[model samples]
Target: MGILTSPIPIQAIKTLCTNCGVRDLCLSIGLSNEDVERLASIVTQRVKIRKGAPLYHAGEPLRSLYAIRYGFFKTTITSEDGREQITGFQMAGEILGIDAISENRHACNALALEDSEVCPIHFPQLERLSHELPSLQSNFNKLLSREIVRDHEMLLLMGNLNADERFAAFLLNLSHRMLSRGYSPHAFVLRMSREDIGSYLGLRLETICRAIARLREMNIVRISGRAVEILNLDALRGLVAGCNRHRQS
Candidate 1:
């Protein structure tokens, strides 16, 4: 695997550095002594990306694997028609760019939606580290598996989900993901723009706006520009669950 430059903070990547969002996830999962050292050696702080910054573009040579440190990123690929297909969103503690592991180039472009930081871990050194650390080998396997599943779900959503269905599902999934990361699932700002959300959900930008307004009318959510609050989470869940029945109808 070719290594690319990273944008994580140097301080946060230092071993014994307790500031990394993925520390608990990375450390607690499994790692060997040698693996830890090799991993640490290649770990470099990434350049901080402001909102709308390009972390890397499609067709760029893959140099390193990346882990999001803070904020959100939207990954997309351009089609033959030059249309953009939103592939996925990356959050803090989540790994991005699995395709580069084998492909040697970024298949999709990773873009920051807010001021964001990424940590680049050199892959060749990481391969050696994983060989020495059995737990790390297992950890790598699990991460790739999850990436496959996520891609499958994205494909399904893009092909089959309708406008309202897409909105409800996105809100439900986003809330659950944030809650897993110890963030306030209900009272969080949407760092991604409506257009990006539309791209991912395969809906029109106006449809995304209208859906958010409808949620507010139902008293299920409160939206003020990018800041969104799930005012009644139970009601929101009900709306999402209602999608299956609505689809059946």
Candidate 2:
């Protein structure tokens, strides 16, 4: 099959327009439109990240916060046993490395699951800017809070839900999120492989495959390689109704 290309048309970028898309997450969140443009001028051009490429790695100095413009990202943390525990996925318009604001090194490995583009907001420059600009501080603070909420949710999901339940809920969550972003809600590409998804959901690779097959058999999902079509969200969410029980063993 031919590669899928981005649909956005090429145009000359003025500072204002480039910051508009990621204002709430990467640039100035609550700043007036004019302030965002002032900040945008300092940012680098959009950088393409190929599939399986590392955007940043664990223990690397947190030189910048990356704002994903398109495609998917998976981050992981390696433990003492050398096992990588999947952290979370970063979608387009989301900020990466926000959690490392206080830390000098990145805590997780960030990898592109598909071809992607990210705009790097250099940390040293941003930190200085933040100290000088009230808008930058407010925006970064808001981003920090958002990251905390997301991480808290991930911790809760991992600590409480079983593999199958977590997988189902994750699919529902992804579908809903993409839909909210005006992307295809039912049909979309899976940027990550089954192994990556399984790791994130705390399931065996084979179990992930089996779960997808089960969803297909139940007419809830149609899966083809990395392409998935959610046939039924209501039924999928039903699989883990009120599954808030944390791991006790």
Candidate 3:
């Protein structure tokens, strides 16, 4: 277990959605200025989580849904035998703790991969606000739908793809997401370690290392420790497609 720290108090400060950098990608999207102000009211506190510390633990009662203001996080679940399975990696502008909506307790643990800050939205207040704000309700529904689609995609990725293909898909997926967040798609740093990535992808650490070497040999990517630069974006995408390219128009 990582060392836990108390959340820094910020009663004097408030981060409003109108001034937030990631508002376009977050809940403020498609919302009126008034709606955003209403949201800002409920999001009264911002909590900073230290690296390696959990934002929330599994089976803990869900009090708030977190909007990641900065940094990276990984969600995982532990089995009865104490085997931990990485469920997903989340980044800035993404929401966490949605999995607890049905059970009222977190099904997985959320931990910061680096020093992070999150705006905690109290669940009950959000529910009442959503009732009055149709746009908020619609956006919340979309968030839920997106989670379901992501899960289905992961199932397909693990079930149908070979190791190499899975590795390619993972890189391409990361690239796309980074691009969406206004980061360079061709080059980026990996926040999670290779072992953490393996856990998420259901591959061995050695297998991940080999995949990196194989990509380098093919002149498709350049990897130096945690930094990765895709040398041939099209070639990398083709790797993910594999034989399926022949079937597509």
lDDT of each: 0.74, 0.74, 0.86
Error of 2 at 195 (Å): 0.6
TM-score of each: 0.85, 0.82, 0.92
Q: Each candidate: how many clashes?
A: 12, 0, 0
Report the C-alpha displacement of residue 215, candidate 3, in angstroms.
0.9
Best by TM-score: 3
Report the number of the highest-lDDT candidate. 3
Superior by TM-score: candidate 1 or candidate 2: 1
lDDT tens per residue, model 2, 17-48: 44455445456656666666556655656567
Poorly placed runs, candidate 3 (over 4 Å): 1-15, 244-249
**How does residue 20 of candidate 2 score in lDDT?**
51
> What's the TM for model 2?
0.82
Evaluation by lDDT, superior candidate among 2 and 3: 3
What is candidate 1's lDDT per residue for 1-249, written digit by digit as tens?
A: 122345545444555334445665553255544445556667765646777888888998888887777778889999999999888888887777777767798898988888877777778877887777777788888888888888787776667666666687788888998898888999877888898898888778888888877778778888898887888888777766563323311
Which lDDT tens digits does candidate 3 get at residues 5-71?
Answer: 3443333323356778788778778888778878777886778888999999999999999998888
